[model samples]
Target: MAIHELAVNAVKYGALSSPEGHVTVVWHVEDRDGAQCLRIEWTETGIPVIAHAPRRSGFGTELLTQTVPYQLRGTSTLTFKPGGLQCIIELPAKGVLQ
Candidate 1:
């Protein structure tokens, strides 16, 4: 549940972190191998990136992997870019949310 994680982060360490800190979540779809794949990106502008990977077990990470692919029948990949984290989840074109 990205929505849930976003909410939690907003309350804990996201937009509310400071007046200048902000987070953006976006998604789109494209055709790949005759199927539609969902590409989602999460960008945090003001948070510091102290580690290369998640420090502890967390629901956000778990949900990002499990819920998106298993539940939605998709494939997902994540990358830590220069500015923020990017996640791309690919699902069957049929029955997807968008």
Candidate 2:
């Protein structure tokens, strides 16, 4: 659901809006602060330019910033770079991993 929202936004107003733009999604398990975590990085590149972050928070922003951290006890960050946007999400990987 989180990832889907990202893709939706990307297609509507992000790098995906541009003909030459691209989006990359990657994930891995790693240790953070002595705890194992599943880190997912969503990156957008090849955008012509990005003026700045959105002026207001949307449902996607609330989900990433509030819901994920509060409900899943994870962490997330949304960054607007010169060329595109980058979102990093880290979720606890305790019993979920085998």
Candidate 3:
């Protein structure tokens, strides 16, 4: 549902708001910090403006920063870029299907 939140946000204020914009999501399994992990990258481009990070945590932030990592027993990093929001998630590979 992380992607869903991002899509909803995109439709509301980011890339997906415009016909020329788009979002890219990629994932793979790899060894990280000596442990197997499912790595995912969420990138957005052509949004036309940069969205500054909110000062306080919101539902979307809570999902990306707390729920996902905690649920997967891993970690996540959410970045606000000049182009748009970028999120990197690393989930423990214990239950990830190869």
Candidate 4:
């Protein structure tokens, strides 16, 4: 659902909106605070111009900022850079696979 929302936004208003824009997704297991965790990075680049963060919180924003922490006990950060939007999500591996 999270990725879906990002894709939808990209298609409607983000990097995917332009022919030259692109999105890269990468995931791996990494050690954080002495614990193993899954880290996912979503990056958008090649955009001619990047929009500023929305003034209001939408469903997708809420999902990333609120629901993810409550349900997954993880963290999500969205950064708006000159290139495009970047999202990083981290989920603790301890109970994730169970």
Candidate 5:
């Protein structure tokens, strides 16, 4: 999936919603339980605040909860913290192309 959508969504409502907010994405290939896998950590900082999760799901939620995992055979978890949102994704490295 094109990350542009995700970035756009973030800019519109999530991490990038505020001028001071920032997003950091990091991914690496490593051995987990003896299996090669790609682990991604998405962290958001400087968010004004996080009251709670959205009552309704939207494109961002769908992409993170459904699209990325189902399409890429990955497992993902999204957490909403008072500080910011944190997303973690891990997938088989064999399925990835470099």
Candidate 6:
């Protein structure tokens, strides 16, 4: 769901907004304390800078801070770069099938 939201945003306002725009989504796993951790990244380029963070209160912000984490059992961080947005999500790998 978070991926979908990010994709939609990219299409509506981020990397996909212009001819030079682009978006990248990647993920990997790391071992920590004998447990696996899944890390996902979403990056956007070619978007204009509007705000340092998401709006104070909105559906997007709500999802970023609450819904996504609840559903994935993970935590997320957002960074706005000169080009666009970057998001990182980290999740525990326990009980998850490969």
lDDT leader: 2
Ten contiguous residues with the weakest lDDT in model 1: 46-55
C-alpha RMSD between model 1 and the true structure? 2.8
Model 6 per-residue lDDT tens digits across residues 6-87: 8887887778878888888899999978989888898887777645665565566578769767987878888986778898
lDDT against the true structure, per candidate, is: 0.64, 0.90, 0.83, 0.87, 0.78, 0.78
Which candidate leads in TM-score? 2
What lDDT would candidate 1 get against the real structure?
0.64
Clashes by residue pair, model 1: none
Superposition error at 10 for model 4 (Å): 1.3
- TM-score per model over all chains: 0.70, 0.89, 0.84, 0.87, 0.83, 0.84
Candidate 4 Cα misplacement greater than 4 A, ranges: none
Candidate 3 — what's its lDDT?
0.83
Off by over 4 Å in 5: none
* Per-residue lDDT of model 3, residues 1-98, tens digit only: 87788889889888899887889999999987798888889888887777677678778879988888678777878888776878888888878765
Better of 2 and 4 by TM-score: 2
Candidate 4 structure quality by residue, lDDT tens digits, 1-98: 77898899888878899998999999999988899999889998866666576778889999999988999999999998776889998999898756
Quality of model 4 by C-alpha lDDT: 0.87
Over 9-85, each residue of candidate 2 has an lDDT whose tens digit, in order, gives: 98988879999899999999998889999999999987776868878999999999998888888899999987888
> Pairing residues by index, what is the TM-score of model 4?
0.87
Question: Which residue ranges in model 6 land beyond 4 Å of their true spot?
Answer: 49-51
**Model 5 Cα lDDT, one tens digit per residue, 1-98:** 42565577678777799988889999899888898998888888777667666688777778878987788888878888876878888889885846
